[model samples]
Target: MNAPARLRMSRTALLPVLILVFCVVPLALASAWTLVLLLIPVAVAAWVLRVGVDIGDDGITARSLAGSRTVSWTELAGIRIDERNALWLVTTAGTEVRLPVVRTRDLPRLAALSGGRVDVPAPPAQ
Candidate 1:
């Protein structure tokens, strides 16, 4: 019953971007050309907010700045964890969808969201 919508990037991730935007304000006032500099942080902030993994009872969706793809539980062949701890969903079609902000540590969360379509090994007993 835990409806956790863990976005790909935490909202807190935007703090630095916001700071950069604010810091550029004075420079923007000094020269109109400097205003163009704001685009970087703005784009980064937009990316952070827009891109991410969305796990629901029926499927997992990988979101990007350009688009999103959803893989239903039945289409999920397996899960892969890369060297960087990034999570990828391997489909029956042999395609892979990288789940942003979803590392190996988040597998349990995914299992819970999957409602038993996914399984994770239980943590070892200490």
Candidate 2:
């Protein structure tokens, strides 16, 4: 069977989950203030996870928690893994679109599709 389209996790999803676990957990047990803080991270996580990137035969589709975008293959520039380890889709114009999520196990698949390069551009000199 032909494999399914690729979907990457949202890097935007991580910060909040980690924050909630580390910063909010203890505060949750002690005070209402902390409980209120919980809403922020939870909301962020929900929004980020809800968003996703779909790579299919037609092209790549990026659906954010708030909206969705579709770009044809012709517009695809490349892909890259950031220093933070998030996968980003680079457009021909050089804009970096963050993928929904990234997993180590998925690297091989992504690399294959990206032609062995993740499109990670070199950092500009200071």
Candidate 3:
């Protein structure tokens, strides 16, 4: 069996996090108050870096700023894409779990990871 596919924020999404951390370093060194402000960039980086989705044969695991949750294939009722292009996993209990950083382009990978549990929508006729 193939290993799980891990999806994370694209490098473009991470650029702002890196820039903020670098920009804050100077200010953080200058003042005590600024030092406290340093936490902002650190938190942003952590949030951006930690948020991801892991799809394996067993289930889908989503990690966010709050925490991580894994839903088995049997637990998922369906998957849908929102107007914003975010992927949402609808649970058997009717709960929606939003997958951060999951774009439309990632649907194929997600479908494959789920072993056909999730359906990948067909592309619109061009």
lDDT of 1 by residue, 1-126 (tens): 446365677789889998988888888778878778878888898899899887776688899989989998889999987899888899999999999878888888778777788888666899
Q: Residue 13 lDDT in model 1?
A: 89
- Candidate 2 on 70-119: residue-level lDDT in tens? 76677778766677777677789888777765554566665566444344
Residue-pair clashes per candidate: 0, 7, 0
The C-alpha lDDT values of all candidates are 0.84, 0.66, 0.85
Clashes of 2: 7
> What's the ranking of the predictions by lDDT, best on top?
3, 1, 2
RMSD of 3: 2.3
Q: Where is model 3 more than 4 Å wrong at Cα?
A: 1-3, 11-14, 123-126
For candidate 1, the C-alpha RMSD (Å) to the true structure equals 3.0
Off by over 4 Å in 1: 1-6, 122-126
Estimate, for each residue in 1-126, the C-alpha lDDT of model 3 and write its tens digit.
Answer: 568788987757668877888888998999787799788977887887789999887789989988998888889998878899888889999998999889888888878777788888777999
Cα RMSD of all models vs. native, in order, equals 3.0, 6.7, 2.3
What value of lDDT does candidate 1 attain over all alpha carbons?
Answer: 0.84
Say which prediction, candidate 2 or candidate 3, comes out ahead on TM-score: 3
